[model samples]
Target: MTIFIQSFGYQLWNIITNGPEIPTKLVDGQRILNMNNEFTDHEYKLLQLNAKAKHFIFSNVDRIMVTYEGTNQVKDTKINRLVHDYELFTMLENENISSMYAHFNDIINALKGLGKVVTPRFR
Candidate 1:
């Protein structure tokens, strides 16, 4: 499936940028972060580690939590989660940050907090 970067509806954008609510998934069984189809097989291999992670996004940051999924295998090599924030777009404008990806990674490392920040590449 093409991982939706952001919902196109104006309502969705409203919720994403200005809305106070953090995005969440259905509260059913275990939830998995799956964006494999968003990439080619080559890119998927590089980012395969994301399969075992849980991503949460709020405000401007996304935290990627690496954890065990259901009764499946466990993961413990990386930090709890990685964050990416669109607020970096502001930095881009100010010329404070260069590559968008690099700036986002820096923000995640610096500002990661208790239970805050998912989503990997796109959006």
Candidate 2:
């Protein structure tokens, strides 16, 4: 699970940095932090945690949340819709389990409330 999350995080970072055309699934959050060199200690920690959570959810749960904008605002309609679809897809793909769905909802809500754009490679 850790490896899965790490790989996903690395791929996500690469996608964000080098454009979304990259056919990869791992996003290296550490690389992103090193590349930016502007994130505060607390922010870096949070980013790492988010990366881990994303990796876990995507790899094991078979769903990914796509936010309309970056994570830096109150829960908007689009973001909420995205989350709903993501959870619904996960439920459909998996065994209709709701644990991961609940976890992702909490994470998305937290990110929406406290997450900043940091340095998105994508525009």
Candidate 3:
């Protein structure tokens, strides 16, 4: 889960700094993470986790709350919703930069919240 979140953050950073097209290289004449191609494995992993979380009732058992800071205010939200937001934004190919940045910031905040849940020192 952490890897998926970090990878998505990297891709989001690339898009914001460089453009919609992710900067990448050609490997064996095949393009990866380029303008024409995007990575979806992380997204798929998240989807699987989302499904399993529901199936096993893990989402309810765990208390992974995210402190979402919106444009005007801040509030608490469950990590499941943040995961849902991640799935939603990745599919929005035409989403504007500001919205993307908003989601990116929210995800960063979510990561910090998650760190608190995982590491006792953060708590």
> Which candidate number has the best lDDT?
3
Better of 1 and 2 by lDDT: 2
- List the pairs of residues colliding in candidate 3: none
lDDT by residue (13-105, candidate 2, tens digit) is 544444433112235643222344555666566566656555555565532333323332344555666555544544434544577668666
Model 3 Cα lDDT, one tens digit per residue, 1-123: 334334546544333334343345588999765443453666455445444434433343343233223411332345556655555545258878888788677765785675423222322
Model 1: residues with Cα > 4 Å off, grouped in runs: 1-91, 94-102, 111-117, 121-123
lDDT of 2 at 80: 60
Over 27-76, each residue of candidate 1 has an lDDT whose tens digit, in order, gives 46755454545456654543432321212243223211222242122221
Residue 94 shift from truth in candidate 3, angstroms: 8.3
lDDT of 3 at 49: 48
Model 1 C-alpha lDDT versus the unseen true structure: 0.39
Using TM-score as the yardstick, the better of models 2 and 3 is 3
Worst ten in a row by lDDT for model 1: 70-79
How do all the candidates rank in terms of TM-score, highest first? 3, 2, 1
Best by TM-score: 3
Evaluate model 3: give its lDDT. Answer: 0.49
